[model samples]
Target: MFFLGCFATATAAAAAAEVAAPVPGYVLDNTEVREIHAASLKRDYQLYVALPDSYRASERRYPVVFVVDAGYAFPVARGIASRLHRHAGMEEAIVVGLSYAKGDEGVYSRRRDYTPSVPRNGGYRSDMPGRPAAFGEADAYGRFIATEVFPHVAAHYRADMRRKIFVGHSYGSLLGLQVLLTRPNTFEHYILGSPSLWFDRGVMFDREKAYAAAHGDMPASVFFGIGSRETLAPGKQRSRAEEDADMVADLRDFHGALAAHRYRGLATTLKVFADEDHASVFPLVLTHGLRAYLKQK
Candidate 1:
């Protein structure tokens, strides 16, 4: 939750901190970094970007992938991007790791910003009154990204907006769905890992069904994944087994609904990792999802 880097100049300081030798075949370097106080959310956020070696030599623009909850996931994503670059010479990408303000406040800040709407009578529903109070302002948050964040990154760096990809986990997953449904073309590809689909009593599934029935072709590539261990034990020991089951059920249903659409222009796949828990599956999900996206591209 610390500032990965404050200004772009800090990149050099970070690189120097790790002056020790590199690890065998692997290499490390700090790319450009930026921090912003998003007016919509009223909180500062950090972006950690990693560039491939070839990026320095080429004048060509590259695709950009926004990874939500980047405080923890950035390392995993950096590894994936490097491996793909070294082995397959895959097209380079600008990897941005999204982070909110530091400490416990960040957790609550993400919960408020990432969530869409609160359910009136659902297990996860907040005790707060009205949808806006509990779920915060999802529409405003999305607008901030579309208007402020995306444009800032595009203008400051060599990013290909046409090939934009979004990767989100849990509540961030809900934000991805909200964007996909409301602004279908915002992101060309979506990597949603362990989406909190049970939010608002499966509201996203309802939205997806309606969109499928009304629309013809949805042009997007989506990769969905959930850990095989996405469950809770039914007993006095566990907090809420029923709630866990309901969440997993909703995720599967949403996955099935997207499959049913069979939208010709849309390519989507879902994976479940037997050994992974909700928190641990992110690395694997990013690894395989990026591979799939590269292949499709």
Candidate 2:
């Protein structure tokens, strides 16, 4: 009876101490949350900036990789970069994760910021059911990155402005495409993963047509990766709307288009991962892409 009482008392005291103690929150290494405001858009965004381990030790200006859809991609990219740099012999770059509008839900903000144009002739986005009916201002959003984000990074960090890289997936890829088409110089390298090319009635195709008509070359290194299962199954007949949403065909066609143009100094790579769908293939895209593009020569 006496021993039981003492053990219980000790356990109770330990539990009380634990309850009173400060709880430690999770933290990523060398990462900082920075709040930046877009003057033109009148919106504030959070930047998840993760520095390389060598950043503090060296005076070298590192390349900066700007990743979109930061809420999910930031941490994953950070981890991948670290692993790639440590074991895979890839050059370490400063990873910058671009967040959505500070106060708005991500879906709302991405619809407006990541899309190239509004839908045409009642074209519905079946994926984003109940998404805001009207939104597509990527031109303005691109300005925000060029004007606000780039300058800010250049002014603050030891970032090599000439070697900017962009990594984006799905609708995020739409934004990347717009930037690549309209302002190729904004990013020297682009890793576009499973792009949602069916958005807005294939309006991006029109944009590409206009770009080709004006420019002789698109100077950039581009990589496109998609999953095999993103298309319809064997002999599975889908509706016209569903067939139109075939992402696999979309990426392949766009890649072919880019190649057919024979743009001077435009390097492009396309990879399709087997046994993976849209959601399952994103990590592979990043891992394979960063390795292929950023590998130490």
- Report the Cα lDDT for candidate 1: 0.75
By TM-score, the best candidate is 2
Compose the digit string of candidate 1's lDDT tens values, residues 1-297: 247546545887778777764667533485767887787767677778887677778888888888877777777787787778778666668888877654325556576678777555544543334532345456667787888789888887778888888888888888888888777778899998988776665677787888888887778888988887786555623322335544455677787877777876778888888878888888888877787776432
Query: Per-prediction RMSD in angstroms?
Result: 10.2, 3.4
Instruction: State every prediction's TM-score relative to the real structure.
Output: 0.78, 0.88
lDDT of all the models against the reference?
A: 0.75, 0.87
Best by lDDT: 2
**Residue 26 CA displacement from its true place in model 1, Å:** 16
Model 2: per-residue Cα lDDT over 1-297, one tens digit each: 999999999999999999999989999999999889899998899889999999999999988989999999999999999999998788999999999888677777888899898776565543345654547889899989999999999888999989988999999999999999999988999999988877766788778889989998999998899999898667765322435477888888889888888898899999999989988888898888787668584
